[model samples]
Target: MKLDLTIPSLGPCHVDSPLKLSKQKGISTFNYSDDTQKILYDTSLKNFEACLAKGEAPLAFEKAGPREKIYFDPSKTKAAIVTCGGLCPGINNVIRGLVMGLYYRYGVNNTIGIKYGYEGFIPSFGHPFVELTPRNVADIHKSGGTILGSSRGKQNVSEVVDTLDRHNINILFAIGGDGTLRGVQAIVEEIERRGLKIAVAGIPKTIDNDINFIEKSFGFETAFTTANPIIRDAHNEAKGAYNGIAIVKLMGRDSGFIAVNAALSMPDVNFVIIPEMDFELEGENGLLAAIQRRLAKTKHALVVVAEGAGQFLFNNELGTDASGNIKYHDIGIFLKDKIVEHFKKQNMPATVKYIDPSYIIRSAPANASDSVFCGKLALNAVHGAMAGKTGFVVGRWNNQFIHLPIPVAVKERMKIDLQGELWWNVLEATGQPMEMKS
Candidate 1:
């Protein structure tokens, strides 16, 4: 069980005098140089530069600065903000930033907070809209969770639209993950069908970071940072016993961004399993056998598995949530049970520590990085909506804010690129056996 000692070293990857980007006249300008811009975009750069020629180019993410654009008369606009899906860090930051952006920056004093996501619009739920002001939402960013709250259910598009029209909402900011964005899509379709003049803007809120086309969703860094301590605790617990195994399961039902990042953050992990990769349970190359091999070499071993990992071994009969997302099998508990059984069958003694810190990570407030990200996304969403841009979500494309069409955003789920640099980093960090040979 000797681990690979010759880890690949990352070479210097820096450039002098990087592209200078500036915001002017509601457009982000990248002072293009022949060398970098050509290689960066290839032929696609032509389309972007063409847009810039037409006075439309988004800010490059490398610049990472703020810009101001006034698309609507603040005095006559009414914007509504609603959050759905499960809680994640920085939800409140987005809410606060959106409120502040609309009320103060745009002079749009009439901002409404829809309680409990789209459910707030259903008449039977009795979840009415609350007026959002700078005074009321000033300190909301200091805490976690949404001040407007959230829920998950397939809402009636007609009812939701009626509610929006009844309230005379001009700009609607829907914040949630994939399912939430899908719901917004339906609402937008209804608006178009009915010939309404409402604008819909979405804030991508996938804690799992599974939504496609967005580089990195908000709260992902916060989740990874928060999970570091939890995994460290597991490592310590495993080390305390004679032959110990620590198996920690994290959120990421469809992708393994959280699990892989968490594993990279901790060096004690001996194995990292994600949903994108397949692993067995009983054979020599199986997860249990891997643990046995690691235990033979060391007194303690740490394993990290994404919730969606090893799902193929579980039963096919799955239950769907209110949003129709299938609930994943409890990989953490299942691994714990199998480990105990495997050791018992061999008459070997071992201690297994199981840790699930999902709720804690999701419930915490945004870290400093996420706070800034949420602020920028919220601000840009406001700008896009007021400019009559509908059916789009504000997302970070190559680091700059791009008003990603909701259809494009929800077209596919973003998964960890196994062959990409991030996964390579994870593999190097864990030093896990790439091919668990029998």
Candidate 2:
């Protein structure tokens, strides 16, 4: 699908940047980015050639960094930050980064934290906004979750915009996933309808790494890294007994990036199931039969499945969550029961162990890699908002940080390509069947 990469702006930039950096290229000099700088959306030569052949310009995103001039006045600007949706590893790091970047880098000291997602904006909720400064946020990065707190569900757009106006907020930094970004879009619409000049900037937050046009979201690396050792533990559990089996379920609602990467990180995984691929249960070529075959030869097996995998097996209707997300059936427990039943029918004694580490992995402190990445995302978001950019998200694309319009970023989630190298590598690592369908 074609994408529009244009970023909306509040107005022309007039105030010079507080960051003093040498414009010329030198050993110690730093360069500032301008609106003209762009990063290509597609890096593949085939797609680039195809676009040129069709006489269409390759889509590109505006590069994210400090500009020579900004729109918001440092001394008078008031900014607020809010986090919504599920917990991730790097939320605190992002919050601290924003506060430090605003106070130390841009000379903007007037900042406040919105408590409990968008609900904090509604007057009826009676939630108080926390005043943010460099001192309080200095040590928040050592922990997980947001200091500002978070919640699910959508708030009324009019009420949210009303809060921003009441607080005289000049800029807003929203941190969350697809649902949160959609909320940002609605708030932006409301702000424009009322002819408000508040700048809205989003920092895409999803442990699943499913945001579109973003190469990798913060906390994803830390999440998969945290899961690697858990897979090893499952492998050890399987090896401790005869015909032993271990089933591990990881986080992935519509995509299986964490499951795929965690399985690849450890080679002991014998079977990898994901939402993108379908598998049968009761045939000679099904997952149960495959597990039986593996146990027959190795006497032990490890299966890593994404939470959204094998959803077709369920016949009952599941309701949606507070955030309007479909409630998925627990695939880990389902597999455990089916495997034990199949073995009992065959008169074969087996030991089955099921592990779900979804919450634990997501709520841990950000690792070194994610901490640095969170800092970059937060700082870039501050830069964009200070320069009057609105209705855009700060993300990494093709190894360069760039600004992505909220509509474009939330258009569709990034899913695994079955024919792509990442999946191919997973298949090669696990030695699992190409298809588990009967």
Candidate 3:
């Protein structure tokens, strides 16, 4: 197969993207198409904006003078460990490694986990924030959620820096996905402006593999493991039911990686919808028609839909839509209602159940493989922050824990290659509806 790539250059909408193909011996000539160029430019521009918005440095930008990393001698001070974002598996494991590594291994005792993410930086609600030592995190490796709670809130730069100053926090370790990193960066920028001495590092920790800044974010493998069982349970449960349809929803707020992966793993899934999958509202019967067609002689249907999929197009609970109607407490219910309506129209015997597997999968125990990867990533982030490096996120690349410059994390949307060996075959064989468009 000859591979060609297109980039927008020369003229806006006029010049075509250029491509170079690889043949047996060498590379091919440069070719261009207007459509390719336009797409290339548009994608690049959006990513560029994301980088700026996140305060992530550009991958292509060249560093000037005095741009070097700073190394902290851990023999002196303790680091801060924080977890933000929705709960994911292996979070406790990361803290376990960090606490253990800083205490017993490195002789640093003052490790504190910021409570409720950034929201718990200070004492409020009678909590006054909490602190963590190696003692508290000792048994956490086997635990599922965070020993320290997490929250979704606006960035509090000054207050966080003030807390750091009061606590004498020197090295900061932030554990979460992209949003948490943004919070970390906000604090770092404040410290820099105020001339405070501190180091910051971020651990990629989202069940959704959409953290583009890093490859193979932590908690992903475990999320996949957690997700597979739910899908399998649902898929198999379909085989034994009477005129039944089970619509299952898994978590992935803005990304569809989880949904795509789950649906592909199960061969019996009749319909799969993810944010990345192109879908539009059909007259109530369209989805029903698809389900009815996929209904086996057993009259049972299994469908896996991403929690965040089709959020903008449909209502989850009632006839009217609200602001956060984009999110649903039970996505399965939404699908089940529509499915039941379809069956009712056809006058077929029908029953529906909506399984909200959000917490079920995300709060489960860490898988062995995921724990290994999470530990390795946590260690690498510590090394990076101590090294005075800025902007890069720590993740697994090519089966190894590595540091990706913040710029890389911001600009690229990591996509699964649908034509690749394992992924391609698995998805195709199942007859799932994931569109393989770049």
Models 1 onward score TM values of 0.86, 0.98, 0.75
lDDT of 1 by residue, 192-310 (tens): 88988788888999788888768889999999899999899999999999889888889998899999888888777788888998667878787778788778888889988888888
Model 1 poorest 10 in a row by lDDT: 1-10
Which model is ahead, 1 or 3, in terms of lDDT?
Answer: 1
- What local lDDT score does residue 342 receive in model 3, on the 0 to 100 scale? 67
lDDT of 3 by residue, 1-438 (tens): 111221111112211111122223434632211121111112367777887898864333111111022245556676888788788899999888777766654456777777778776754433354567867677887878887888776555787888888888888788877667777667767887887777777777878888763446667777766777777777666765777777788877666677766776656666666655455434433555556766745488877777766665553454323212234444567667777776787788877766777887888768898888777766655544544555556665434444554544545455545455644554565564444222
**Model 2 root mean square deviation, Cα atoms:** 1.2
Off by over 4 Å in 2: 25-28
Candidate 2: give the clashing pairs.
none
Candidate 1's TM-score? 0.86
Model 2 TM-score (2 dp) = 0.98
Clashes of 1: 3
Error of 2 at 71 (Å): 0.7
